[model samples]
Target: MRNVGAFACGLLFGLGLIVSGMANPAKVLAFLDLAGHWDPSLAFVMAGAVAVAGIGFRLARTRSASILGAPMQLPTARRIDPRLIAGALVFGAGWGLAGFCPGPALVSAASGQPRAWLFVAAMLAGMALFAALERLAAVRAQRSQSSS
Candidate 1:
């Protein structure tokens, strides 16, 4: 039942992306372009998304569990640390360059877009690399603690 609910939600999200032209790289690039024929349509979409998410978060804050009876694991981090800043920069760079963030990239890839496939592959590689680097850092920290 949980899996079914998750699938339904994901399918709906993908459909929304497609309907909103978010899954189209050209549309996204046009939206990003500021000086040359800038398209502000995506800005409206983004604003709507932000508004909806804000309301959803506000409601979720009052709940202990999700509708699926699972624990509500919302983000707890509030401080804007260097790591967060760096991550935001990296994410923005990727989005600007490829015109496809993770969600839209996945939707495009599922629709058999070649560029989206490449983007998804690169994204996965970056995630894997980040995981490996984190593991290495953890090991170094553990060793340093043991030596101390």
Candidate 2:
């Protein structure tokens, strides 16, 4: 049942992206191009998303657990550090270069576009690389602390 609900929610989200023209790279690129042919449609879409998410978060705050009986796990990190800034920079750069954020990239890939597939592949590779680097850093930190 939880899986079904998740699937439904994902379907709805993808549909929203498609309906809002966010699944199209050209549309997204135009939106990002402020000095050129600027598109304001994405701003409206973002506003709608923010409003919906605000309501959803408010409602979620009232619930102790999800419908699946699992406790909700929210982000606890509030501090901004170099890691966060670096990650955000990379994310923004990738989005700007590809004109497809993660959600839209996945949705676009469903259309069998080669570019979309390549983007998703690169995204996965980056994620794997980051995980490996984090693990290495953790091991090194542990070793250093033990030696001290």
Candidate 3:
């Protein structure tokens, strides 16, 4: 039942993205373009999303567990570090270039668009590379600690 609810939620979100023109890369590109033919429609969508998410977060905070009886696992990080800034820059650049963030990219890929497929492929490759690099760094750090 919980899995079904999760699936329903995902489906609703994808549908909302499609309906809001968020699944369209061109629309997203237009939204990001400030000096060019910019579209401000997505700003309203984003505002609505943020407002709803804020309300949901407030409501969720009142509960110890989710509707499915599972404890909520939220990020506890509050400090903005170099890694966070770098990651935000990378993410913003990726979104501006590809015009597709993770959720919208996945939704767009369902439409059989070549651009969407390429974006998803590159995104997966980036994720894999990052993981590998992090693992290597951890191993090096552990070895250095043991030697010292």
Best by TM-score: 1
lDDT of 2 at 107: 96
Model 2: lDDT equals 0.94
lDDT string, candidate 3, 54-146, tens digits: 999899888889999889877689999999999999999999999999999998899898899999999999999999999999999999999
Per-residue alpha-carbon lDDT of candidate 1 for residues 8-127, written as tens digits (9 for 90 to 100): 999999999999999998999999999999999999989999999999999999999999999999999999999999999999999999999999999999999999999999999999
User: Where's the lowest-lDDT run of ten residues in candidate 3?
Assistant: 68-77
Q: For all the candidates, what are their Cα RMSDs to the real structure?
A: 0.6, 0.9, 0.8
Candidate number with the higher TM-score (1 or 2): 1
Best model per lDDT:
1
Using lDDT, rank the candidates from best to worst.
1, 3, 2
TM-score per candidate, in order?
A: 0.98, 0.97, 0.97
Model 1 Cα RMSD, 1 decimal: 0.6
TM-score, cand. 2 vs. native: 0.97
Cα lDDT, all candidates: 0.97, 0.94, 0.95
